[model samples]
Target: MLLCFALSRCAVSPTGDKLYITNLYEDKLLTLARDGTLLATFKDPALDGPYGLYVTPAGQVLVCERLSFSKLQMDSEDRSKLATLATRERDGVRYPMSVCYSSTTTSIIVGQWVNDNILVFRVE
Candidate 1:
């Protein structure tokens, strides 16, 4: 799908039908149908420099905010102020540049870009 704004990150819904795209420049999350129709826009909890995103089995959205443009560390302790933050789990690990739930493995594999390794977490 052609994004009016550069798509910094995107995550397919668990149903594999919808998509949530993060527009870094616009600081907005655009929800789109499978056919690329704009469904809704969310504000307030605006994402900053969002890099990676994923949808959980329970249908919750997860966004990885890359602090300082490319750094993986948390920008702040509060997390909300940090440039790199996970919107879903409070205790979610850091530097999750990529994530995927594998049915075969039954685990959530998190790709740490800078770390150059995949962290596998069992998903019940």
Candidate 2:
């Protein structure tokens, strides 16, 4: 199925078989099969202005909440919140607009849009 999104950022699955998209204007994450069929939509109050998406080797989804300056993790299978990984003041992450997981280094790298800095957190 073909879906239309106003503003979206996408990340390829770790296995390279699917796509995960952050529907920024809609506050949701969309999962699409390789063939472009809509698989699922993930939505939550915490997903405010979700701007970035990254899939981990363990099949975890990392989301960057631009408006909230928070990072969230969810199970790729069920789209259930695994944790609120980081918050603005608590973690010193500001205006996080993009995210990527590094399996080799076991860390998550965040691009702070407003702060103009990149932060790396070790996965623990």
Candidate 3:
């Protein structure tokens, strides 16, 4: 399938106070202040290699990793740990490279890196 890919490697919170960035080679996620000061760095077992990111309208953070069995993980509201959004099989997408949430449609959209495909999951 011919699909458009949108990389989401960095994002700013809805409040505009913080920035979230993924280090593609280091397997780490960084949180920064608007002034470019590092606030925190997170490393999660769920993340193989961080690639892309998406911040929800409500300020929720989601990450896309590069491994074949990669994930779409949501950052806990406290910005501490990452929680998997769904099981691997249920995600139905491989090699995720981008993530986005649609409030109007109540859905999650995923883009792949290894292949030209986009996955859309409705959120209830």
Candidate 4:
């Protein structure tokens, strides 16, 4: 299927061979080859309105769930493991629209779109 709307953010794999895209309207994540070949589509109820996407050095895919204001992490290759790292109401996240994992600092940064703030959390 062609990605037409709500294509929020994208990230390239550490190896630069794959592309990961977040579709907010469709509530799914798309994996594509470097040559734009469709590889896989990941859809889950927990993945509501995914916006920003980041590929960590360890090959973890981090996604920002816009409407939910949550951060989700999954295995980049297969998305076998999915976890909610944070939430707005419980974790002080307010409308998170973007996310990035810092290997050097061992932390995750979330961009709070509506609240106009940035939240940083140290990862263990």
Candidate 5:
């Protein structure tokens, strides 16, 4: 049997024309168009077991790594780039399971897999 992909999470873009998917085992992110065409593939160096995905209104994809416990940014311009965020506490962000952007607080909320605690980071 041939292994296809290790897709773990997916989130639709703000405009609802694109879909962002996270591959946990492969350590990559895939962006697909509305018509199911592969737009881009992001293989960031910091993508250590990425498990969660969140897309901002300005067309930014936030990736949550399970092992690194860090939030990496994937901007619209560069599809194959991941920049680690520094605003997060980084202390107890272990096993980041999921991510969601809260517009009310202008922050990114991340939920862990093991500890069951949520970490909130305000993007400045």
Candidate 6:
């Protein structure tokens, strides 16, 4: 038997002409053209088993690791490791399943898998 894989999360490009998908098992962010052709991939070692991805208005990509409990920046052209934010007091419930930023980009909304609630935070 063979197993087929598919996209787990998707983010619309800034121009809305492309789509970015995170492949969990592959640990890569695949860029697909509007017509579904493979365009490019923004590779990052930090993307190991990445589950959730958040794109800022400034075009910054944040990758959330479900097993590592770390958040990494995806700006590395060569996929270098960035700062690893450890789990805090607020993350006691479970690993983060999803994340989002406010319009101003001064806050973050985290959705945990175990809690099943959205946690809001102010960016300092």
Which candidate's lDDT is highest?
A: 4
Stretches of candidate 3 off by over 4 Å are 1-8, 68-77, 86-88
- For residue 84, model 5's alpha carbon misses the true position, in angstroms, by 1.3
Ranking 1 against 3 by TM-score, winner:
3
> After best superposition, candidate 3 residue 99: deviation in angstroms?
0.9
Best-fitting candidate, scored by TM-score: 4
**TM-score, per-candidate, Cα-based:** 0.56, 0.83, 0.78, 0.87, 0.82, 0.67
In candidate 5, how many Å is residue 28 off? 0.7
The residue pairs in collision within model 3 are 8-53
How many residue pairs clash in each candidate at the backbone level? 1, 0, 1, 0, 0, 0
Residue pairs clashing, model 4: none
Q: Worst 10-residue stretch by lDDT in candidate 5?
A: 67-76
Question: Candidate order by TM-score, highest to lowest?
Answer: 4, 2, 5, 3, 6, 1
Candidate numbers sorted by lDDT from highest down: 4, 2, 5, 3, 6, 1
Which lDDT tens digits does candidate 1 get at residues 1-124?
Answer: 4466667778777787778777766665667788988777654354565666666666656565543121121111222222332333453455556766677887766676666656666655
lDDT per residue as tens, model 5, 1-124:
1145688889988899888888888888878889978887777666788788888887777788865444444535566544566323555567778788888899988887788678877876
Which is better, 1 or 6, measured by lDDT?
6
The C-alpha stretches of model 5 lying farther than 4 A from their native spots are 1-5, 68-77, 80-82, 86-89
Task: Provide the lDDT at 59 for model 4.
Answer: 70
Candidate 3 TM-score, C-alpha based: 0.78
RMSD of every prediction: 8.3, 2.7, 6.8, 2.3, 3.0, 3.9
Native RMSD of candidate 4 (Å)? 2.3
Error of 3 at 118 (Å): 1.0
Assess each prediction's global lDDT (C-alpha) against the native: 0.57, 0.75, 0.68, 0.77, 0.73, 0.62
Q: Per-residue lDDT for 17-119 in model 3, tens only?
A: 8888777666777787899887877776666677768888777777776543233333434445435664347665577877889988998888887778788
